[model samples]
Target: MDSGQGCVGLSGRRNRCRVTDSASVAVSGRPREAWIDVAKGVAITLVVLYHAVMYLDGVGLAGAMAPLNPLLDTFRMPLFFFMSGILAATAIRLPYWQLFRKRMSLLLYLYAVWVAAQTLFLLALPPISPDGPNASWTNLVTLFIRPSSNLWFIYALPIFLTVAWLTRRWNPLIPVAVTGVLAVLFGSQILHTDTPWDKMGRYLVFFLAAIWLGPRVRRMVPHIRWWHMAVVCGVYLGIVLIMVKLSLTRVPFVLLFVSILAVLVGVSVAVVVARAPGFDFLRVLGTQTLPIYLVHTFPMTALAAVLMATGVSLPTVAATALPVLLCSFAIMFALAAYRRLAAVPGIFTVPVASWVDTSAVAQRAEQAEASA
Candidate 1:
C-alpha cells in the first residue's frame, strides 16, 4: 500500500457521516478522517493482495490469481496517493524545516532502513523464488538513481512532498498542468524508465490534484450521489476492460485518462463504503497500512521459504484463496509486530534530532515569513 505507505494512520469508519473540512477531530493520537482511512484500507488491501498472489505464484503456490493483477493495477496506488494528498493539504502549509522534520525526514528514513532490511533479508535467506535485483542488494548502490524495492512508494513520497511545497505559492493550476502533462508523458512509457520512477511520474498528478482540491473535496464527498458513483465507476470499469483487452492503455495518454477516471471511481467507492456496514474492517486496516506495507512482503518471504521447504502443493481452490488468506495474515502479522516493536524508536518514524540539513530550509521559511 505504500499508500500515503495504508495511510501509514489508523481509523475505524463512521456511520455514513459526511466529512467536512472543519472536522479535525483526533483519532488514536493522530488527526484523521475515517473515510480517508477507509479509502486507504481499500487501496492497501489491493496492494497486499497483489503481492500475496505474486509471491505465492512465484514459488508455484498459486497461479489463478494472476488476472487480478491487471484488473486492479490502475486504481489502487492512485487512490493511495489521492488520499495522501487530501491529508497533506495542512502539512504542505508548514514551514519547510518543519515540513522536513515532520514529513519528509521520516519518509526517507523508512525507505533507507527498509531497503537495507530487504537487502539483508534477500542475502541471508534467499527466496526459493528469487525476485531479482529489486529485493536484493544488487540495486543498493543505484538506489540514488532509481529505487529498486517495493518500498519505492516511500522513496517517492518525499519527492512529491518537496515539489508540492516548493510550488505552494504558485497558481495551483501551474503545478497541476505541468505534472499532468508529465504524468501522461511518463505513464505512456514514451520516456520509459525504472518501474518505481515511472510510477512516481505517472502518479504525481493525482497527489497534486488532491492537494489543490483540498477541502473542496471533503465538502463534495458527502454530497456525492449514487448515480454519480454508478455512471463514473461503470464507465471507468468498461473503459479499463476495453483498453486492457485492446492493449491500448499505453496508446499515448490513454492510461492518464483511465487513471483519472479510476480516481473518480475511487471517490465514489469510498463514499459508498463509508456509509455501509460489514466493511468496518477496511477502515481499521487503513490505519496500519504503513507498517504493513513496509513489512508485509517480509512475511511473504518467510511464508514462501516455509512453503518451499515443506514442498507443500496447494490445490486450485486453495490457490484461488491464498491471496485473501495471505493478505489477512500479512495485515495481522504486520500490526502485531508493529505493536511489539512500538517501544522502539526510529522503527516506524525518524529518530528525533537527527540533522538532515533541514535548518537551511527553516531559515529560508523564516526569511519568507519576515519578508512577507
Candidate 2:
C-alpha cells in the first residue's frame, strides 16, 4: 500500500490495509539509509550530555551549565520523537491487529520492564538530587495512567501509534490541527493539569507531521543548501537575541519558536554529519539506542554517588567534562555487556514478533536486485 492510504476509524470501527510497498528497504540485509541512524545518534548523545551536566550541577560537583542545557533542550527530545513518528508511519499501513500486537505491544512491554527497573534502582540508592522527583512504589500506578519517568518516551510511542492507526484514513491535517490546538492550550497554561497527556499533546503534532511529511522531508534533507543553513542560523540567532534582551525567554511562544528552529538546525547538522564518514561510532550508538537509554541512568547515578563519596574537587569545566566522558563511557560499556541478553525478552530489549512486512521486504529485495 502507498504511505498515504490506510484504514482509519474509531475503536471497533477500523478497517485493515494491505502492505504492498515499503520505504528504505534494500536487497542486502543492511539498512538503506544512514541519516536516520545519524539523527538518532546525535539526539541520544545530547540526552546523555544533558543528564550528565544537570546531575553534576545539581550535586554541586560542577558549576551550572544552565545556558548550555537550554540550548540542547530545544531539540534533544524533539529529534527523538520526530524520528519515531517518521518510523511509525510505516506501520500505520498494517492491519490494525498486527499494529497492536507488534508495535504497541513491544513498546508497552519495554516501558513496563524499564519503569520497574528504574524504580527499583532509585530505591536502592540515595537520590541523585535531593530535590529530584521521588519514585515511590506508588508511582508504579502511573505506568497505566501516565509515564513514571524518562521511560515516558517509550510509553508515549504506543499512544502515538494507536492514534496514528485510528486516524489513518482521515485527512492528516485533522489530527494535526487538533493536537496543535491542544499543545497551544496546555503549553500556554490555559488548560492546566499535571499529566503526561499535556506532553503527549505537545509532541503529537510533530509525530503526525512526521507521518504526513516524512517522505517529503527525506527528499528535502539531501538538498539542503549552504545558504539555507545560513538563513536558518541567522533567523535563530536573531530571535534568540530578542528573547534574551527582552527577558521573554520564558514566554511560551518564544519557547515554541526556539523549538521549531532547534529541530531545523539539529536536523541540518545531522544530515551533514550523516553524509560524512567519521561518525560511525555514533551510528552504532543509534543502532542500540534502546539498550543505552534504559541503562544510562545507572551510570549517571553512580557517577554522582562517586563524586559525593570522594568529595573530589575540580575546575568548573572539568566537573562538567569529566562526568560526561565517564558516564558516557560507563553506559557504553554496560550496554556492550547487556547485548548478550538482548535475545531474552523483558531484559534489555522488548520481546515481540518481527514487525516488518516479510512480503514487502522480499519485494524490495527483488527490486533491488533488478536495479542492480
Best model per TM-score? 1
lDDT of each: 0.71, 0.62
Clashing residue pairs for model 2: 1-20
User: Per-residue alpha-carbon lDDT of model 2 for 1-372, expressed as tens digits?
Assistant: 011211111111011111111223433565536677677778878877777777776677655464557655557776777776766666676677766653455456667887888788777776566586436887677687867656677677777887888999999889888877766676566675577666766677777877887778778987977667678778777776676668765466665567668777767777777777998776656655666666677777766766665666888777657656855785676576565665454464333334322244433333342222
Off by over 4 Å in 1: 1-31, 130-135, 309-311, 353-372
Q: Per-candidate TM vs. native?
A: 0.85, 0.82
What's the lDDT for residue 306 in model 1?
A: 78
Tens-digit per-residue lDDT, 1-372, candidate 1: 332221122111221101112122353344555677688889888888888888888778765786757777789888889887876666677767767654566567777888888777866764457554325455677775779547888778888888889999999999999998998888778878766888888899988898888578778887888889899988998998898889886787888888888888888887888778888888777766777777888888778877776778978888888878998899888888877774465666445544332344543432332221
Q: What is the C-alpha RMSD of each candidate to the true structure, in Å?
A: 6.7, 6.8
Candidate 2: worst 10 consecutive residues by lDDT? 5-14
